[model samples]
Target: MSEGNGPTEGQDKVQSSAPPNAVWPLRDKEGNVTVPFAYGTIAFWQGKRAQEYQTHKWHVYVRGANNEDLTPLIERVIFQLHPSFNNPTRVIDTAPFHVCELGWGEFEITIRIFFHDGPEQGLEIKHMLKLFPRVGEPSQKKPVVSERHDEFVFNAPNEGLLQRIGMCNTRMPNGGPAWATIEPFFSPLNEHEELLRIQAAQRRVQAEITLVKEELENEEQILSFLQDEVKKLEPSIVKKPPGT
Candidate 1:
């Protein structure tokens, strides 16, 4: 919502699921397979990211589902930045699902998060791109930034997926979950950190919007007061002679 977890303000429940031989993804005490939650986020930054580039710069970042760092958990994350971008689709297998490019146009980014041979069905999330001040406008104010959060509920997940989730959350035994390991197999840091960064940037835009609204309200009040004062005056006050 405004400043909370997935499903943004307008949309509710980004995603959920089901399957027969499926068990919940995660587990808690009493050896029960619990439903696992995956958080998805999309963030954008607008400015001159590259000095030599003539066009404006836009930076986009994606946070994996469930706040799980895909760097170590999944095989790769694909991002379809935009049609204008040369070779728009990218396969990322690192810390940041970030892309930097030079352009004045904005489009929707389709992101696919896939896991390696875990038999777990992949997830998809899309975000609309935004750039501050629009095209052909002065960049006097802070760049227009936007961040969205969404989540998926993995219900009745396959056993393999459950094992994958267990391995990710450190519920594994000796080395890790029998299917996977703990050490470098899963990222040490959570992906929510990136989401926090995005939210912080989005807050700047929100603050600016609030300030602009307040200024507009003040101006309207001043104008209304002036109108009232004018009405209080006699029409003859500013009336001029027939010929001057």
Candidate 2:
């Protein structure tokens, strides 16, 4: 009843001989002209014989009685005959029984049944068929910056920084009284680098402004000196003084 599970029980086996009022033709291993049987629902052969029903492979089919239609009862029979209904790998396919050949008085119905290995094998077969399509396909690549850098340093606040600085000092050479005398230039080197850039930019701007102001002052001083000389020369060039 569940998916992929075959019949559970009550599957009747084909008989060796034919039943009453049934007719069936017998064929050789190659399906050549053989013999015909009368009055039998099922037929059988001695030793090993090859019979093909549904699958390409040939199997032996033994005849049985029960002249009634076997198609309707097939489901019940398979369910009874198969091992377990819960097996994960088993799959069954069934078809309506049909009359292959007509005999004297008896009739025979041919049933086709098939069983598949499992889903995994079927999937593997499919993948094998698709290998050429998957070949030469490009794989995804990740950016270099996606990975974290181990050398990147993280700095803490003043109190924590001082603690770490003190710890480093304890391991220094001639560490006793030198600590008080030597100024601990906690060169927040990392911080200092940033501060250095900011200070450099500020100094450049200030220098530019100072140069512009000095140029303007120099120009004003030169203009005043020129005006004073021009005024003193104007009196000398004028016509006779008061004594004249």
Candidate 3:
């Protein structure tokens, strides 16, 4: 459902400083800025039949988790599409980072994230483009969405970046808090949903393990009974004379 990236070191030079007590989500005591983001593709079918070379209309995007605006931290988002299309390298320098296209096939998409501060190196991620429904699944009016959630950890960030992080007013759904108080980018409601999904998967796996163990035990018992029966019949089995 989601994936995470390793922590990256920010510029060591402090551009300025902020109040030590300012509250911000994903800001640890060590002044690290952890920004949660997601990237995926959403496709809509174009009628029941393929239109020339195009079968569907789709858009690929990168954005903050829970649709949070990432304009403050990210400088730009670069998407490298398949070479078959004209001008495969696309760049978006705004909050709505996306690219729209029409195609009938799937390929690997390479995304690069550039920061506002001086890291000099942009973070690179790879995502597989999906165009078809999964096996045994039916299609409907709803768009097919394939997404992955992840985080960008900037260790020892500079002060200008810190100020921007502090200025961001993260709102909780259903009007919980004016400011982001809890853990990372996700609201409490979303977090709870994700937790429940994980728990359900774990339960299913555990039940399967138990069933396999029981089946193995039954098989062992049957094999042991057969072996014992063979031992009992060994003496009674007719023996032919060597001369015969």
Cα error, candidate 1, residue 118 (Å)? 5.1
Model 2, residue 17: distance off in Å is: 81
| Candidate 2 local Cα displacement, residue 243, angstroms | 27
lDDT for each of the candidates? 0.48, 0.26, 0.64
Winning candidate number (TM-score): 3
The digit string of per-residue lDDT tens for model 2 on 1-244 reads 1122222233233331212322322223553322111111111111123222211111111111212222221221111111222432322323112111111111112222321211111211000001011244322221001000011111221443333322221111221221111112111123345457768989999999999999999999999999999998997795877887
Using TM-score as the yardstick, the better of models 1 and 2 is 1
Winning candidate number (lDDT): 3
lDDT tens per residue, model 1, 177-244: 21121122222233467568758989999999999999999999999999989888856487678997
Per-residue error (Å), model 2, residue 164: 35
Q: Which ten residues in a row have the lowest lDDT in candidate 1?
A: 1-10
Better of 1 and 2 by lDDT: 1
- Cα lDDT of candidate 1 equals 0.48
Q: TM-scores across all candidates?
A: 0.43, 0.20, 0.60
Backbone Cα, N, C clashes tallied per candidate: 2, 23, 0
What tens-digit string does per-residue lDDT give for candidate 3 at 99-134?
A: 777777788899998888737798999988887778
